[model samples]
Target chain A: MGRIRLTLCVDDSHADDLGDIAGAARRAGMTVEQELSGIGVLTGSIDADNLDALRAIAGVTSVEQERDVTLPPPGSPVQ
Target chain B: MARKSRKRPAKKQAALETLSVSPPEQPQAGGSAPATAPGTTGRFLVLFDRSAAPQAPNTLRRVANLSLASAADFEDGIVEPEGLGGADAVMLPDLAIAIASAPPEQTHALGVASDTGILAIEPERVVYTSGQGWPLNTGPAASADDMAPLDYLRGYRDAVNEVYDRLTGQHDAEAELGAEAVTAFDEADATWGLQATRVVSSQHSGRGIRVAVLDTGVDSGHPDFAGRAVTGASFVQGESVQDGHGHGTHCIGTACGPERPGILPRYGVAHEADIFAGKVLSNRGSGTDGGILAGIQWGVSNKCAIISMSLGAPVQVGQSFSQVYEHAARRALMQGSLIIAAAGNDSRRPARVAPVSHPANCPSVMAVAAIDERFAVARFSNGGLNPQGGQVDIAGPGVDVRSSWPRPTLYNTISGTSMATPHVAGIAALYAQADSTFRGRVLMSMLTQYARRLRAPARDVGAGLVQAL
Candidate 1:
């Protein structure tokens, strides 16, 4: 099992960076999917070549693994 | 005006039944003299057993110009001071109040007061008379139209205006959420919690986000929804696309109700967006995947920027079709539609119950859990610690929240991730509206980053609880 990072876009200029990230991921032997611009949902294998490539890309403001999504604990009733 | 024993019944019984948590601290000087300062006449008359008073903090407190009376101070959340004892004999009587519906205990008291014809209820609402029929006696309720005396015109004006002021300060709740929903402090944000209904009036009110309320139909005639363009269709036969169950109304209300407290710049989200209501279930709240599928198709085709699904289908355990659902969610994402789904209410199990529901279990969509102000997951919100790690995207306010309902009225509150789902959808809309270039990755990323996570952290909480920008 492997982990993929997610990034998002705030403007159109971020579009090209999306392609770059996907290309880097492709080179690294991993899958890169674009939900939109800086926000790309990554999954599958981590390609060695793409690892250093995408991280170096500009405008990649933030990155987090998909599985780390925060969830609330159970039964917080607010009456 | 002796206590007319023959005029009505329950007066004496009701008076004797009046109980207080504790004796008024002042013990004297009652008469609307303020709860803290106390007047000679209105000292509390404890009717219940002396030890029966609740030991919580006393209701006696003198704030800056007014003494606040906690709603909790009353037995039924209402205080009827004059009726606590013989209307004439009660000392320093300030105001006597009772619900217009007259709960059994209150009914007896009013019935007795009616003997002296002292009971004067407003035409359609509650009216508190001083002792008997004298409306102007308390000075707060006396209508200006009643010509009693000229010398006290200012007092009468102040009293009636007090009532009138309350009625006039309607706050112009833009989305027709009514007076109950005053623009309040968004305790979550630590600022005024922007009115939920005000989401309707804005430049990009969900224009990019296509929200599908997958529940009962919605009230098209709602004032917040009035004049706004929306497409209507129903899976329920003969159910003319109106909010019958009221669930959808609330979900949609929170996502994007209407706008107020703005132009002056108040806190609100998602001003540009259009809603596509998916009436998958019948008005009675039951439906199969067929209607749901149709609703989803509608959302997909209409190019909704975001689709909010608050309902769930009970799928059996061990049965899995994760691939197919994931594929559809993937397709929705590719189509530029951000799908925000409720994590589902299955608090009984910490693990995602199976056979998991469709749509929500889909990988491409963002699954949301419900949380309270303290950032705890709601009892009903489904939890997950993903085989991958955190499964939920982020949490939103799913607690007791007021939102839209089907008419004769427009807004109220109900709890469920169903209520929570649209809140995320609205924020997504806000993101998309603010920046059209915002696609799935950017949108979800922003949401996850800004979300306030809970103790369950990676397990019960998803990306974390969502915090407003």
Candidate 2:
């Protein structure tokens, strides 16, 4: 499986333990990129095959894939 | 005045009979006031037990009366008189509650109300509205009859000449948007959304508030903003703050343009607001997550009251929300800044209702939908039912909307939730200006409460069209 960027939502109660919780991703061969401390979310890339194991980790609420965003192109039927 | 011993009407009785009362939840923290601040003579809304009789309405009112008789705000001060009269109490049987004036001594009030099987007590919200011709300004003076007729004509000529000279000088600095538009602009009322929201009549111009527009930068040199207070920075590497794409300029114009443009119709709202243009997207209207996140951090750190982003990428159906952006938005809100983003124009309405886009799909960010002049959902405006996170929060004028643009094309007509998002942002600025107490969640509540309820479904126009003042 290929590496994929993902966003993880951690339970707010366990937000203070993000450093320890992030070890789970490292064990699963994921590279944690950004730690959004305010909202209790972390963004990183992980092997697609390890996604299931990542979800089972404690304190992890949700895992969503990071995707690209863009503006509405010119003459792209905005109306 | 005595309490009127009126019977519960059949309709009200039926509603109260089915309403259930849940246990009290933890009150919101972070400087949020208690549900009922003690000793204040403000109204309190008390919830009753679901299985309680329809007559429980009176029971809740009585609880408030007893609680008010011993409130703390005035306990050791004045000996005020009071009666929980008919006019002082209002019952909403459908919601199984009654709102009555009281001194909000929570310990006493909650204990009394709970005895009557009450669920919770909340302060009656104060609805804010920008009254007609609010922030009133002096109108044009009339000519005196005693003055010579020629003098009156001269006076009028001088006034017109002065205004004309100023307008020409401004417009000449930049190319005219269009000759036809110039003729129509002066005669035009506020853009449809502004008119619908009553922003045109509002006197609160978002003065002293900083509004950050994070998008494809803005034309800082635009004539409409010749003397306006604007600050900007570019997050996109190798790019300047100048807007090559017109999207940022148009969005900025709608959210914080001048009250009266040199030659165009009044298209802007929040006219006096300070503009903070953050270039998150590249000139090509594209940017990565890092750039946008940086922009968000910048806006919040500067203590902006409102952050408007008329940009986003599509989110697939059934896709989960971006936790990263959600946290960023929550942090912004906690810091007293509101982030409003476009709900995405990916829908092919009457065919497919696409989900709201990323960043906007996050709960903390207010997602704005697009409505046309007819008040119908625009063909491209996304709908609710994403099943996870993306949902429309409010609607704004989007179709065939005219606003400022990049140079050489000083104006343009476009449509999308992008156009609508700025409308909400601008109205938010007005709300922020009208009341110093309004910020973060309270500001959001004021917007929804004062919104003009539209005929569309909640999925189409969450709380309906956002109102001004």
Candidate 3:
């Protein structure tokens, strides 16, 4: 299965324990990238087949595919 | 004064009650009624001094023998007209105003009761709109009635012109010179966006407030921002906070450049605001959700009052917003930080309109649309096309916007919803500085509430163009 980068939102109840949620996510077949404790979010990569496993982790409210943003070239008139 | 009862007959009371409950009656077109004088309902509007509002009911009873149904007596202060049975007046305690139908003598008595706190008494008038004028008789027209339609058309045209004049401050003698009134903004001394948003006349300078611009980065070495306190951090990996791409510098320039620049025409908004430049995107103008979220976390941790993001990836139609972003936005608001983002510039206009881009599509994040100097929605500016969590919050001047750019190119003029996002961010800083209490969700609401209403649809302009304090 292909690996997909994702952003996981921690539940409010587990917001103070982002470290524990990150640990849980790691055990559920995810490569932890960043732990954004201020906003209770974790970014990582996981196998497509193991998506349900990551979602099923305790304190993980949502697991969304990361979206990329690109602006127009500097020389472009409309930015 | 002695209280004397002047009870109305039961039949007359019922008629008055019906009149109060029913919509205002439309006068016949070209009727005998004088055109200059406004049509009045039999009821009078009574104004009371604020300090005297609480005693209004008792005062009215003592002075004019008029009993009042106080709005405060009802739940949530919602006074139902039909529920105001047998009362001579309905008193709105909060507004210190009253609507009443009383005899001329009683009204005179209330007006003269200075000790009782009555301010003024005036008759309520019948209001009409340009779209729905006094009902015109569409039946067979007589030859003499041909002039009537012409007259009505002239009146409608004048009403529209008058409203436009008031909105754009075109009533001044200088603006009476034809074309200038239509395009009221002149960038002789300041950028057209600043003039259009009333930033030129604003007194607040965003002093003591921290504004975070999460984009590529900012040019700290720029001459315009020489002595300004700018704190910067890079969330993008393998890149320094120094803005290699011009996008971040331009945004920072618009939001917190300088009071007096080396070049002519002021472009920045909050000159005194401390700048927190968070580089979330790479020098190539690209970034992932993780970098953006990290930037947000950094801004929130620093207690930045305003976080402006002029970058977003366009979402497809019927696509729901990211729950992760929405939750983060809510958390930011809870901590007294407002997240503002561009509503995207993927639309072609007059052909196809696109939905607001994400993270902006998140409900908690304010989605700012772009308008031109003429206050028309930009062709590239996205609209709130989706039903779920994709509403445009407000608008700002974006087209032909002049602001700071990287060195060797000190200034640049561009057009996009990207340019508009900083206008809002800058103005929000001014508002935050004006009153320290205005932060997070309250600041967001105030921005919309105080925006100048435009003739455009709410989907295109939201609450209209964002204005300064």
Candidate 1's C-alpha runs over 4 A off are: A1-79, B1-209, B261-269, B314-321, B348-357, B385-390
lDDT of 2 at B124: 45
Shift in Å, residue B334, candidate 3: 1.5
lDDT of 2 by residue, B1-469 (tens): 3443233233322322232222113354542333322222345666777776375644644653332222223345332335343254545555666555533342234444445777776544433253532222122332121134455466599557657867777433111100111112223656666777788889899999899999999998889989999999998889999998888999999999888886657888999999999998888888877667778877888889899988888878888777768876877898899999888888886668899887788888898998876677887888776855578888898888888988777888888899999999998999999888899888888888888776566787889889887
CAPRI-style grade of the A/B interface in model 1:
incorrect
Give the whole-model CA lDDT for all candidates, comma-separated.
0.50, 0.73, 0.84
**Runs in model 2 lying further than 4 Å from the true structure:** A1-64, A75-79, B1-189
Measured over all alpha carbons after superposition, the RMSD of each candidate to the real structure, in angstroms, is: 22.4, 18.8, 9.2
Ranked by lDDT, top first: 3, 2, 1
DockQ of each: 0.04, 0.28, 0.81
Say which prediction, candidate 2 or candidate 3, comes out ahead on DockQ. Answer: 3
Residues forming the 10-long window of minimal summed lDDT in candidate 2 chain B: B173-182
Question: Candidate 1 has what TM-score?
Answer: 0.47
Best by DockQ: 3
RMSD of 3: 9.2
